[model samples]
Target: MANLRPISRVVQGQRMKEGAGVTICRTVGTSMLRNLDPYLMLDELKLPAKAAFAGFPDHPHRGFETCSIMLEGKMEHRDSQGNHGVIGPGGIQWMTAGRGIVHSEMPGTTDGVLWGFQLWINLPKKDKMCKPRYQDYQATDIPVVESAPGASVRVMAGEHAGTAGPIKMRNPGLLMDVRLAAGANFTQEVPEGWNGFAYIYDGEGKVCGTKAQPEQALVLGPGDHVVATGGSGPSGLKFLLIAGKPIGEPIVQHGPFVMNTQDEIQQAFRDYQSGALQRPEDNPWKGEEL
Candidate 1:
């Protein structure tokens, strides 16, 4: 007998402007759902094809990791550590801003609509100052598991049906992109004490017993697994099921940086202002071509 997770609360994503005036739907880092333990923020990018966008300019970050999942468009990333890459549809770029990092992500497509999501995951105190690294994967690089008759799951971070994601991280977590046909059911095991949620993006569905719609995030309660049923719509349902172990530490965040204390947050600012946030010697990817 498996314990099914229940929907603790439902939060609708709020529209906000970020980076260089890029419109995004923010779900996790808002007043509705402040912070979810190991997860800090989740933003959905939906830019029109003909829209004029400035894109995200150079920025600094620390004490966390950022994962960009491109669903329909392309994004180009370049960091101070000399790591550069372009992730297109069905691709992911996972960057660990351990000690510190300065980077920029800009639109890589001009004539096509840009759609994606950026997730911010917190790092534990022990590995907060570790060396920064990146794990990028193309669509074909990731593993997909046929979970049910009409359900498929793309494992992004953790194991699913004996298949594992390509990206490696300091923290243990699960990031999955699930697609379900109409009336189909899907289930996945989640750690008992982990905090997690599901963000519906494509169609409507029922998470456990609660009705879920697009742009709605269902914060889950304690359980050993989650169960969901696809909507009756012609397009079916699509969502991102993300869960992670709790860091259980004080979070002090200032704009792009997140630390465990106010003093550390201030120090991050000082380091960035003094142009010493990321040391030159610490950049192993320097001068390497993408």
Candidate 2:
């Protein structure tokens, strides 16, 4: 049995403004250290309104894959592949930054609220130089299973109950968006031994034999499954459940680039500044006429 590792702490995320007027929780991305190893960073971007969250400017990346899942609004994306489109509710844009590429994300709607999470998953050492690719999973592509009568699990990786996840990776990780009504109880195995965590997005619950109140994110040491139980009240319970194998390597991070060594990190920055990150033909097309 995977050790029943109880939650150690509860850290909540707070919003802050950044590039292009994007508002997001400053803490969640930085606090999830190794909760999902191989998957290095996660930023929860939530716009109070579409006008306020204009999205981000064109950017360069290498040695990582960006998993952008939209929970509320839409995000317009374009890349060097001449690919241009929008990913809305239940949608995901998995962009692999093997060698490198330039891309941009802009808000899709002119009205309404915009909310989503961008998770940066790490690639293995051997695949660092692989060519970049993007896999767009439509909302219909993801499977939703009933974890219980009123509780369900949206499996993104690994497995949950009898359903297998659609995503494939060089790493062993699991991303489950769970929702349970008040007074509901649920349980599931998280492999034999894996590092796991829970970020409560709404309502409240208990995990690993401990309580996880709203706005609190809990990190588990080592465990098989995160057994959660919700309470009876005016609110329901919702959270992000994640698990993965540890990379067990040195992490040298510089801004958006996450590598295993300080030298590699420096090289990444140099490549970007020296105009060596991408080829001219692969230059990402700029949509707007300035």
Candidate 1, position 116, lDDT = 91
Which digits, one per residue and each the tens of the lDDT, describe model 1 over residues 17-103?
Answer: 998888899999999998999999999998873462578989998899899998888899987877789998999998888788899
Quick one: how many clashes does candidate 1 have?
Answer: 0
What's the CA RMSD of model 1 in angstroms? 2.7
The regions of model 2 sitting more than 4 angstroms off are 31-36, 280-290
What is the per-residue lDDT of model 2 for residues 121-195, given as tens digits with 9 covering 90 to 100? 777776665667667777888899887876878887767778987876656778888887887767777765566
For residue 25, model 2's alpha carbon misses the true position, in angstroms, by: 0.8
> Looking at candidate 1, what is the lDDT of residue 270?
93
Show model 1 residue runs off by greater than 4 Å: 282-290
TM-score between model 2 and native: 0.88
Listed in order, each prediction's TM-score against the native is 0.95, 0.88
Worst 10 residues of 2 by lDDT: 281-290
